[model samples]
Every structure is written in C-alpha cells, then in structure tokens.
Target chain A: MPGSTLLHIDGVEKRFGGFVAVDGLSLEVKAGEFFALLGPSGCGKTTLLRMLAGFETPDCGRILLDGTDIAGVLPHRRPVNMMFQSYALFPHLNVSDNIAFGLKRAGMARDEIATRVAEMIALGRLEGLERRKPNQLSGGQQQRVALARALALRPRLLLLDEPLGALDKKLRDSTQRELMDLQRRLGTSFIIVTHDQDEAMTMADRIGVMNHGRLVQVATPRQLYEQPASRWVAEFVGDVNIFEGRIERREDQRLVIACHNTGAIVAAAPRQSLAGEAVCVAIRPEKMKLSRQGPAEAAIQAGAINRLEGTVSNLGYLGDISSYGIALDAGATLRVSVTNTARVDVDDFRPGERVVVWFEPDDCVVLDP
Target chain B: MSTRQLFTRPARRAAIAPYLWMVLFFLLPFAFVAKIALSQSALAQPPYLPTFDLTAGWEALKAAAATLSLDNFRLIFSDELYANSYLRSLLVAATSTTLLLLLGYPVAYAIARLPERWQPIAMVLVIIPFWTSFLIRVYAWINILQHDGLLNQVLMALHVISAPLVWLSTDSAMYIGIIYSYLPFMILPLYASLAKLQPSLLEAAQDLGASPAKSFWLVTFPLSLPGVGAGVLLCFIPIVGEFVIPDLLAGSGDMMIGQTLWLEFFANKDWPLAAAIAVMLLGILLVPLLVYEHIQRRQLEGKQ
Candidate 1:
C-alpha cells in the first residue's frame, strides 16, 4: 500500500516534432515511494522523468506537486532534482564544492555550506576525496558523488536517470541495495528511470512499465511478475511461455482454454470471462515441472493439472536451474525450468527425450489477447 | 613479437619525425637569429660579424667569438622608440584579441548549439572566409571603412552622421582588420570545446537549482576555459607580431614590432638590431606560450 499522493501528473503529453515521446499519461506517486519507470529505450520513460524534473515542458498537461500546479515553473525553481544517466558532475569543481553548489546558490552561509558539504561527504563515504575533481574519482565513486549532490538540497522528489547504468555487475548489485537504503532513510519520493527490469524489480517499491509513449501497467514487483496485465508486460518482466487460446468455458476457479495446437489448456483466470472470449494463457517456465512419466501414470491431480506431451528439443544448464525447450506434437513449443535442488537426479532430461510437462491451474495466468 | 607489435616500433619512430622537423625548421632558424643578435654589425656579405668559421684556426675562432657582444640588445633597451614599439604592439594585439573574443564567443556558442546536421555546415561557413587570402580580406575592409566608401554612404543616407568619418588610416581601422582576419582562429577552438560539452551537464546544473544564466556561469563557462585559452593564444601570438594590417590600415605612425623589425632588417640594414628586436619579442611572447603549454599539460594530466 502506498502513502498519500505527492505528485499528481495529469494527462501529460510531450512531442518532439512529429514523434510523440510521451502520450497522454496520468499517474500519482506516493510521498515516500521508490517508484521506477521501466521501459525499453525510446519508450518515453526518460521524457516523463525530465518533465517531472522541469527540464522539459509537456505539450499539454498539468503536473501538480503537492496540489500546486508547477507547469510553468523552471527546473531551478521546482523542488525537484535529477541525477543524470551520465552523472553530469561538474568536472571543474571538486567533490565537496560540487555537493555544496546548491547550498551555496540558496545563499547559505559559508560555514553552513561547509557543514552540509561535510555531511554529504560522510553520507557518500567520500572521505579524503573532498578536494578531488570529478575526473579524479572512479565510476562508482562518481555515481556516489552524483547521488550525494542530488540529495544535498533535500528536494521533495529525486529523479534518477539510469543511476546504475555505468556500473559493472558486481558494483551495480551492491549499489542498488545502497540506493534503496538511502531513499528509505531520507524518505524522499524517488523516480528511477531505467531499462533494466531486474534493477527495477530489486530496488523499486512499485514499477511502472512503459511502452511506446504510455504507461502499460503499474504494480509492485511481485504482482508485476506474477500477474502482468498483458502479454507484452508478461514477456518483458521475465521469461514466460504463452499459450494462445480462446475461453471454452469458465468452471469454478478454472478457465478451460481451447488452445489451437495443444487442444485444451486450463488456467486460473482471476477475472470472470465469457465463453469463446479470446485470451492468452501465460505460465512462467519455473512453474512447469518435467517428468518422463505421463500425468495419468504419475497420478498428478486429474482436473487441477494441465499436461502436455512433448519431446525435449533443447536444454540449458544455468547452475541453479535447468531450462528445457519442449516441442509438442501439436506443433507448439513450451519451455519448462526445474530447480537443481540436488546434483543427483532420478531422471536427467536431455534433448530428443519424450517428456510430459505439467503445471497446476493456479500457476497459469490468463491475459486478454 | 607478433607482426603488429613489430609494426608499432617503427610507428613510434615515425611519430618523432615531426619533432625533428620542428627542431630543424623552427628551432635552428631561431638559434641563428639569437646568434646574430649577440654579434656586431658589419659590412660583410652576411652583414654580421662573428660567423662560425671552420676554415679559420682555433686562434681566429676565439677572435671571432670575442667579436660577439650584447651591444645590440643594449641599444634596443636604451632607445625609447624600440621600447615604445614593443609596448604599442602589445596594446594593439591585446585590444584586438579582446574584441575578437567578445565577438567570436557568441558566434561559436550558437554554432555549437546548432542542430547536429547544421553544425558542420555552420563550421564550414566560419572557415569559408579563410578560403580567400588574408590580405585580400583585410583590403576588403578598407573599401568599406574609407571616408567616401560604403559605410560612410550608408551612415549619411540613414542620417546617423552628417560628416564622413575618417575611418581608414587609423588605429581603429587596424583593430577592425586584425579582428576580421583572426576571427576564425578564435571561433574554431571555441566551437571544438563547446561542441564536446555534453548537454547533460547544463541540464544537471539546472536540475541542481541553478538558473540558466547561473548555469552558464557556474558550469558552461568554466568547462570552456581550455577553448578560451587556446583561442586567445591563437589570436594573440600572431597579432603581437602582426605587420600587414597595421602597416596598411593604421599607416606607419604607430609602428608595431613587426614593422619595426622589417624596417630594422630591410630599410636600416641593421640585421643584428632586428635580430635583437626579434629575440626580445620572442622573450615577451614566451610567458603566455609557456602558460598555455602548462594549461594543456595539466588538462592532459587531469584526463589521465
């Protein structure tokens, strides 16, 4: 659950010449939420973030910060700061001065500026580097400096543009955790714009997936992965096997989907749907189990389990899990991943082997086609 | 070693070739001038005493060395004309360079901020003036600035002035010529520095609560210092020793170092005196050149 809304973005639209960068988009960001705008490049996540920071004016819309419309306000006057994707630290100034820039501009006393600079240096753990210019710092250190500089003014909202884009895998992992801690400690609303789904999932309180120029879905990371609103969102968040079908019947909590190639597939349709309605059955690869024995001989739950006969076409060993691609006799390919809980296996599945892939009806998600 | 590694050795050697050329064409001539500055003037074929005589014995070589003196340097220092000419040259060059910067900076900034496709076209426009000979360009200015020329005619027609302004054959005319001739020198480096600046930096500055004007001062200007220094050096150095513009436009009344050096060498046939003047000019120019070099080295070190 989110707190009281702090930013009310209503029908904001931006266009660069003829290309619409951000279509009519409306969203509400909670006061202390660490929200992420996740999308592929050119999906307008960055343009939306820039609008919030006041670097770009929307073609038509009102963005209310705490109920006050700040449409005409300049970026400098707006109570928002952004950490650029390139960090954009002032190359000429030392780390301490860079952090102190905003404070000094606000007419803070020299002593006060120094004290605030010291506090930021401590917060960023940039000790002994106060006098070093931006170029003198390492990439990770530069990122921290940028973060510290953005946080110094204590803006109502902090916009981060791909904050961890420049870091290596090892550094990015630790930095993501650190950023979450910082945002939580400060209680400032954060809007991170990134294309990395895993980064958004690991750090954000809620993720807003964008496509083309509009927000497709906004949900918590778990909900976004488990119950994506559409097929595009499902495939974008994580690996999912899609079974295109039409609703044959809705019985109790199960939806009997008449899939073309696989004949019939049962999915747990959260929403009530009429018979013959077009829908897609989305099942995560990890939810499906692979066995050499058929469902009837294996004695899997009769009506609750959805089973398909297929031959293993390919397999990938990912240390923690083994993913197998199964080509069904009905002319559909489905992927199933099994956890490698134990090294020794009773039956090790390989390519060209006959297998039965099974998943419970509860594990299936039915989305509108 | 691999074939590629073997190739790098010769490439490294080849890189030193330009430095050798600089030593030969630039340093050797300066050394000759310096040697002449220390020698006495004579009516000989070379027109200076104490030539390096290999045919002469050790005793004659020593005698020739004895002929070398600092009299020409002393003469230059003692004469008010030579001293004032150096000062006047500095004043004109400094003023012209300052004017060029004030005029060129905005043009360069505008070009740098032009759309990506238009940037190269605008840069070519700036360099297009350079296609014509520098002398011809300066002469074109004279046609416009002359009392009965296009400028006075426009001023009169517009009722801006009743009398024709004596625009030519003055220090102001010389300044116009110097600025017009050296503007490309100022613009090119400035454009390069400004073009390399990431737009994100300015955006970040504004995001950090600095207004547009403040951002320009706090971020943009400071980052463009390298270009400013480079453009200043490019214009200032040559203008300090500038001859043609001042000679043609400003007349011979205000004698800069170049014209003085020419008169000393050609008119007075005082080779040693001219060499002494050249050495003094070099000495004066060294301070800024060395400062520029120091800045460049520091920038390189910062990058590393």
Candidate 2:
C-alpha cells in the first residue's frame, strides 16, 4: 500500500480441494529490498511464491505487483520471474539459448536477443560455456544459467524458490554472497523462499518466518534473533533455552519471571503479553556463559539473572566456537556456546564436569507459553 | 569396473548365441529358399527333382524372366492402378500415424500427470486393448463406420445427417482401421517418455515468461520428439507391410504391396519370381531400417 512497496499480497489463500496450503496470507515486499520467506517443508512458503509468480492463483485473495492487481494475469504476462528450486534449465537448450528463451518467446529481434544473451552470459560469468547443455555443466554453472534466464527478462520483481538448496555448503556460502551482491547491483525487489534459517539471515534484508500457512514474524535478522514475537519464532530461528515460568512482577518496560526448575527469578521485557501471567523465558544458547565459579554479584543484582548448576554432558567443536551441553539438576539440558579465542588447554571442557551457566537479565526473552 | 564385468559376460554369450540362432533360423531358411528357387519341378514325384541341375534352374529362371521379367516391377511403376494403390496406402498409413500421434499425445500426457494411485489404472486402460483380437477391433470399426452402422444411425437420429454415409470400402475406412489397430503401439512408448518428463522444466518455462502454448512448442514438444519418432516408427513400419486391413476394408479394389506379394506366391505358382519380389520388398524395408539405426546411433552419440 505504501509507495516503497513493489509487490503486495492481500489475504492470499490457496487450497487444493480440502487441504489449505496457504491461508489468508498478506505481506508486501518493498522495492530494491531482498525479502525472504523462511519456513520448513509444507509451511506454504513455496505456495506463496508460486502465487506471486502466477503459477498458482490464490483461491481467495489478490496479488498485486507495482500497484496493479494481477489475479487474472497469466504467468507470461506478469512482470515477474521465478528461479525454481531445481534450477530447471532447459536440458535441450544450451546456456545462451536458455538465457535467451524469454526474449525469443517475446519475438524480439535477433540482434537484440543475441546482445542481451551475451550480456547475461557475461554477467553470469558463463562465457565460453554458451554451447554446453545443462547436463554438461556443473551444478553451480547450471544454477547460474537458471538465474540468468530468470533475470534476462528484467522483471519488476523476482521470486526465487529455494534458490541455493541444491548446492553444497561451501558453494552455497559463496553463491549466497554472489546472489546478494547481484540483488544489490540490480536493485530489483526479490522475494526468496527458503527453509534454511542461516541463508535467510545472511542474504535477506528482512526475513518473514512462516509456520502453518501463517507469517510468524517479519523483521530484520538481528531483530528476529533478539526479539522474536512468539515461542514458535524463538525456537524456529535459532537454538534457544526455553524455561517454563510464571511472571512474578510487572514493570513498565520489563517483567520478572519466576522459573520453576531453577527457582530463579528472571527479568524479560514482554513484547505482547502482560506481566504477572504464565510465560516462557527464551534465552539464546550463545548468550549464556559457562564458568567454574558462580555468577558475579552484578548479574544477580539485576533482579533475576537465573543461575544454574549442571554437568557438562557433551562438547561440540565448531572451529571458532565450542558448544557445551550442560545437563541441569532439574533434568533439563542447557546449551552454552563459548568463543574459541586462543589455544587454551582449559577450553576443552570434558563431560561430567560440574559447571555454572548464567546469562544476563536482558539476554532472556519473555514469551507467551 | 562393474560395467566392464557386466558387458564382458553378456558379450561373450551374445556373440556366440545370436550367430548360432541366425545360422539355424535365418541362413538355413534362406539356403532352402535358394534351393527351391533353383530346383526343377517333376510331374511324377510331387514337384521334386532327383538331383539339382543348375542349368535347368537357370533356364527356368531365364524363361520366367522372359515371361514375368521386370514386367511385375514395371507394371507396379507404370500402371496407374498400381501407382494409385501404392500412393493411397502411403497416404493412409501416414495420415493414420499422424492421427495416432495427435490422439496419443494427450492420453500420454494425462497418464503422465495422473496421481500415483491412478497411474497404474491409466496404464492398464492404455494396454487393455492389447488383450483383445486386433481383427475384432478392426471389424468393430466396420460396424461403426458402415452404411446404416452405429455411427450413422446415431447421427441420423440426432438429425446430424439426413442419410447414411458410405464409410466402408474406402481409404478413410482403411485409415481408421490402421489407426485403431496401431494406437496402443503409439501410446505406450509416448506414455513412457512423457511420464519421465520433469515438471520443473515446464515451471521454468513459465517462470521465464513463455506462455503455456509457447512453452509446449518450444520445450515440451522438442523434448518429446524421441517418443514421437518411436511411435511413428512403431506404427509406420508394420503398416507398410500390412495386408489384412486393405483386404478387409479395400476389398481387392486397393491392392498394396503385401497383397501383390501374396498373389505372386499363391496365384502365379512362380516361386523364383515370388522370391525376387520378396527380395525387392526386403530391400525396400531394410534401407529404412538401416537409416533409422544410423539416426538412433547419432542421437545416442550426441547425448554422450
């Protein structure tokens, strides 16, 4: 509805007979913004993307692009293109021809099609491989060809369905950066659907986490990580230590949560629910600290820096950081991540060692249970 | 490598067994046909000779050549009747093959797109006609197409036609019979090929701004060419050698090569002339077979 909005989906719903794939979903993607619809399988992320591309029409709502309702517009008539999860490069067509397919379909002049195809090949760094078919190219090269084909049309908006799902980790990482760079360079509005949280976090300007055909939260990656709006969002985004608790007191800005397991009062600012009600304390694992000694007086003085005693059950070595699974006395496990700064011999904390895990009051999130 | 092992054992067996079978079934029969072509008929001992006399056989051949000569081949080429029959058969087969492709493609596409539960059912429907007699099916077409037949009766009752049309004993009837008889051959391979087509290709075409029709022509059609080619070959090759439909529907009015060969063998009682005609027919079929193989080899090589 705003001037910056490039694509608008108004209460779009999709159903296959009795099964509701996407239900009354509404969202707007701003111009020149990289928006990601993040969800797991069967979460309606891909269905929403298909509706945007005009492959699947919404049963109940309208999809508008550039302020025009495109409910009845055919996929070819729409000013949008999608990069399918499988890449779907035409096996019969070579790289150049695949890139030039849309242009040729539009009956463009030969010279113009050739020039645009050449430009796309250059832009995709697919030079000298124009004559090679899709099966002849490597996975990454085929991905580039698919991307080139979708981008060649210069659509107003681009829909990418799990764009990097087919690549290996190392290649995915590099290609993710390349895609972000390309998006920025083109300044085209992009709505990418992916299940990978890290991919959404790393690539998107704003991430819309979806669950059960509903948008759980739409915010920047950091905001989503730090201030998730629901228990689903908190758990879906990252590894969170959720402690069942009841609210003890209410303040204007924060609420004091009395956790049952540790018998510790924790402070968290409730974003939605009122204080003095049942809530869950959601603290990110990486935000917690593990120490041989007890927590500092300052942390305890902050009204409820919940301290817990646990035995290290397992250790995970992750290059720059190490994670320890602390089995608490309450029969719950708390994961704590520590930075691996130096080659300290004491960094390798073995199993069965008693440790104290603590986090600041501000690090814990108060969410409705 | 596993491939080498797999091929080596099979290759060794194939190399010896096929040759043995070919010698037993093919070469020996050809030798028998050659012997019969050369032998002289005896009046007393049921057309047997005590010993083979090569000169007598040569003289018989020369006499037959003098009488029969290239006269049959010349007659086939020059006589407007024979020329028209040949051309009509070609046209009928070609048109039937085209119709088969048109009807079979959508059926194949539907079967391919059907859900997993319905796939076997669809496949069974495609194959069910094979369990029945082909002749019965062609005869059924006669019942549907003949004057005052089921189709005409229905049409007249519906006020669609004032009179029954003469649909039998025509090239159109021959076309319908051939197409009906050969439809399963066209549909089965097409279904196999179309079923294997990835849906993502169509999605990609749509995502690239090509309309559904354009996508079908540029993407779906070209990719399915191998199936079309296979279906055409499956229908066309056998129809070229077909005699039953022409005899049943054309009623001796349209004499094809198969009918000609049949007449030469049965009515003329000239075995050597029949063999020559057979050889000519074999020549005509073999060239196309070799060409098809060459084209298939090139296609395989291109894929590699």
Candidate 3:
C-alpha cells in the first residue's frame, strides 16, 4: 500500500579511503512510507542514511528527492533532516526553543515560530515541560525533543539513525507506535536505520535488508519474514531450520529435493531454481506440527504434508506454546512448536519420545544457500 | 560502637579535612593580614603597632584593638596614586585577558578537534613553553622587544618598518608579556571543556537546517561558556596582581596594584597601607573566584 516513489537513490557509492562502507547501492522510498534499512552493525546502512541526509557526499551516482537530483547539496540546504542516535538535543535550548530552532533558521516570524513551536510541543506531547533544558529532561523526553526539532522544518524525508536506540524496551515499543502514527499524520517518507530486526519489522512498512555494503533484499515485513530472498536474510529475520539439499526432480509446481541431512523433502520450488540446483529448504519452527504417535491426525499421510520422523531431543515450555527440538534419524535437528491449548494435556510429549514433524509443502521456503 | 558508626567516623573526618586545610592556611592568613591592615605604621621591630599578642590575654588584646584604626584604608581611598593604580590594574587585566581569549580560543579549538592520537601531543606543545623559567621568559621577551631586538631587526630587514620602533618599556609590551604568560591558563581550561563537547550536538544542529557557522553560534559557542568563564577568571585574576610583567616590561607610568603594593611595602615603608591594599585586592578577586567555582560545580553536577 505504498504510494509513488519520493526519494530515489541511484547507484550510490561511498568509500572512506580504501574501505568501501557503501557499495554501489540503489533504492527507492515511496512517499509517506516508513521504510527501514535493516542490517547488522557495519553493514553500510548508516552510510546510506548519511548520504540521503546530505551529511556524506556520495562518491558516485545521484540521489533524487521528488525528482530533483540533490548532488553537491549541503546538509543545511537540503530539505532533509536526521534524528541522531544520541538524541542530540541542544543542551542550551529548552524544549520549545529546540523545536523552534529550524523554524527560526528559516527566518520565520516570531509569532509564527511561537505557533509552530506550540504545535510541535503538542504533537510531541511536551506541554508542561517547554522551558526545561534537554539535560533536565529524561532520556525519552530528549528523544521527543530531537524528533520535534527535526520535524519542525517539515522536510520531505526524515532520516532516523537508531531512533529508539536510547529508549528502554517499554518506551521503545510505545515510541515505535507513536513514530508510525506520526509518519502517517505528517505524510513524510521516513527512512529509519536500525540493527534491531524486531524494531524494523514492527515499525517499517517495507524493509531493505543490507549485508556487506549491499542490499540483499527489499520487501514488505511479512514478505521478508515468510519469503526471504537468501539464506542470510532467512536466518537474520527469524529462527529457521535450513535443510541443505540438491533438487532431484522438478514437477509442475513442486520440487523434490534429496536433502543431505533431512533426507528427501518435497517443497514448492523457487521461481528460478532448476533440477540438480543446490539450495536450502527453510522451514520456520512454528509452521511444523509435532506428534508422538503415528500421525495423530490423518493429514500426515495425505500427499500434501511433508513428514519427517525424529526423536524429541529437547523440550521448552514457554507458557503459550511448547517448542520441541527433534533430532531426525537422518542426522538433522528440526524445531517444532505446538500451541498450549490447555494447562495440561494427556498426550504431551517429552524428551526421547519418537515424533513426526509435519508441514505443508508450501510452508517450506527455497532460498539460495 | 557499631561498624557503620566506626566507618562513618573516619569518613566524616576525611570529608572535613579540606575545610580544615582551607581555614588553617587561607582564612587564618587573611585574618592576620586584616589585623595588620587595621594597625598603625610605626618604627618598631614589626614596623606596625597594635599587634595581637595571645600571651598578653584579653585585656591586652582589648587595649591593642582600641589603638587600631582604618586610617590606612581611608588614605588608600583618598590618595590619587593608589586609586589610579587600582584602575590601571583592572584595565590591564581586562585588556590582556581579552587578548588571551582571542589568541587562545582558536588554538584550543584546533587542539580539541585534532585526531584523538594527536590530541595529547598538541596539548603538550601548548604547555612546553612553561618548561622554561617564567622570569627568564619575561627577560627573554624584554630582550626581543628592545630597540635593537630580534623583532625590530627582523621587521626592519623585511622592510615592514623603516626604523627600530620603541617596543620596550611600554604599556603594549606589558600587555604582550601578560597575555603570553597567562595563555596556557586560558587554553588549558578551554581545551578541557571543548574536548568534552559532544560533536553530535553540532551535527544535529546542522541536520536541523543550520549551517556550520550558524551551528557554532547556536550550539558550540553556548556550550563552551563554562570553559570561557574558567579561562577568563584564570587569566584575569592573576594578571590583576601581576607585578613582574609590568615591572620589567612597562614604564613607571603603568603602575598596577601589585607594583603599588610592592613600592608601599619596601620603598615607602608603609606595611599597614600595603596590607590594606593586599586585603582589598583579595576582596576584589574573591568574587570571580567564587563564580568560577560555582560554574565548575554546576558542570560536575550536570555530568552526574
């Protein structure tokens, strides 16, 4: 549900001396979309964000904002603002004055600045603490002032470098929702850079997973979770048990892979894989059902379910569900989770019990190893 | 006694040590000076009458106090030479401190912004000038500022000036000497504060549509006020009482309070008036010293 593209990054490359922090990377962020650049530390996500904010000049290529190429534009001249990870609020200025900083720089009238400052204070929910300096406020309050200061200019795009990094877990969660709501209200394209996958998944409309100065994949959160484009993205996004295999045969829509560890498996083929192609069959733990007896339900033998027999090696009871680590006879470990419907069940399985972990063929994701 | 009480007793003693030291060394010395300032100048062993004798008991102390007068302080206020010296001391201190700030700020800022590995080396370079004796440094300046000195010779050779200028024994030379001597005092505090300034604050200012120059005025300059106050007080305080620089580099007309006090004590043999002058100088300097301490304490509390 993203609109037209607002910021188009074309083949941007940045190098600090000989170490290339960001390779030739291209990306497009839609208008009003909360796009997250998700990566591990040192993956060049921060470099790309600095380039977008005009803090760092690209070595090559162009960044177009609303169809205007912004090459050689200085940070202050560019219509983009960044919220730093440290929540670098001006310590000398109060909350209201900090929010009014950009407006005053733009040469707005005093009354206009006051009104805008008031509006931003209200927007950031900083009503009573207008005169308190940044150090006088709490960490979460400082973050709000940083956000209000950045947004006061009404930039077409807002770049946040670990926006919720300084907040505690509870505050980070609430702030994530507040940020999403703010983005929707302001209708500005927000490109947030973070290493936390859960933060990216919870807040971003679309996420670009970066690895080693390159974009591995750009997709919606659900798509990135369910259909990751590579093995790295698969493991980075969520917990998945990957079965290394070579495709033995290809039917019309399904592939039967002769796996090295989990034996033969039938999975829906990726769009580009061929017969004998080496790939990984990835299945999320929550997708598989664990049963101690032979197919407690009749769905296991039905030609659709891919079933593997194993012994329960470990069991974890998390209040809502039970997770079982099953070691297959073919020398592979597969994790299976079952919902805890009742407080206690008569058929609950424990360690050393033989089990059949079953899943639909469509549930398996074929990813490049 | 309980273990907590035992620990608290020694902790309390340790905490009170500094106050005791200040009272014994600083306040008691000032009290002696104040007592001397209130005495009468006389041709005696101590060269002042109405001495406080502890062994003579309270009756003798009362008799001594009855003879004490504020005549020396009254003469200091009424005398033109003393008043002019006080005013000139303030003027010299203010001007030299202004010059030091102008010269020190950029150097301190450059050192602060240096690469972390080079910062220590740069700071050492600023302080290396102090390794030489201060008196020798002032004497060296006098040699260089003389008519046939290195500066005039170099300037004459470069055709910048046609003749050897009268650079020695002037107010300007005294100003130069004071500024050069106290520059490290200015730079060190400024460097300490500027180095601790968060670079991200400037970056955030720039990101919020402020230019680099604007960011400095809006963020960097304001944040460095603690250092500025400290540097100003450090330079201004000692420069007011600076005797050697003005005595060596300046003419007789450029008399500061320190030179005045020295002349009063040694040449004029007026110990009471000299003590009064010293007490007044201390009173004048105490205000800024207290202000500097307040700023340092506020900064420390903010860090916590």
Tell me, by lDDT, which candidate is best: 1
- lDDT, candidate 3, B1-304, per-residue tens: 5546766777977978899999999999989999899998899979999888999999999999999899999999998998899889999999999999999999999999999999999999999998999999999999999999998999999999999999889998998899889999999999998998998888888877789999988988888888999899989999999999999999977599999999989998889999999999998888889978887797666644
- lDDT string for model 2 (B192-218, tens) is 888878888997887777778888888
The lDDT-based order of candidates, best leading, equals 1, 3, 2
Candidate closer to the true structure by TM-score (higher is better), 1 or 2: 1
Tell me the TM-score that candidate 3 gets on chain A alone.
Answer: 0.95
Residue pairs in candidate 2 whose N, alpha carbon or C atoms collide under 3 angstroms: none
lDDT of each prediction vs. the true structure?
Answer: 0.91, 0.81, 0.89
Best by TM-score: 1
- The TM-scores, one per candidate, come to 0.96, 0.88, 0.94
How accurate locally is residue A262 in candidate 3, as Cα lDDT from 0 to 100?
A: 86
The digit string of per-residue lDDT tens for model 1 on B102-212 reads 999999999998999999999999899988998888889889999899989999999999999998998988988898889999999999999999999998888888889
Model 1 regions more than 4 Å off? A272-276, A294-301, A344-347, B1-8, B56-59
Q: What is the DockQ of each candidate?
A: 0.76, 0.59, 0.62
TM-score for predicted model 2 compared with the true structure: 0.88
Q: How many backbone clashes does candidate 2 have?
A: 0
Candidate 2: misplaced stretches above 4 Å? Answer: A1-3, A250-255, A297-304, A344-346, B1-91, B106-123, B140-166
Candidate 3 or 2, higher lDDT: 3
RMSD of each: 2.6, 4.5, 3.0
With candidate 2 superimposed using the best TM-score fit, by how many Å does residue A260's alpha carbon deviate from the native?
2.3
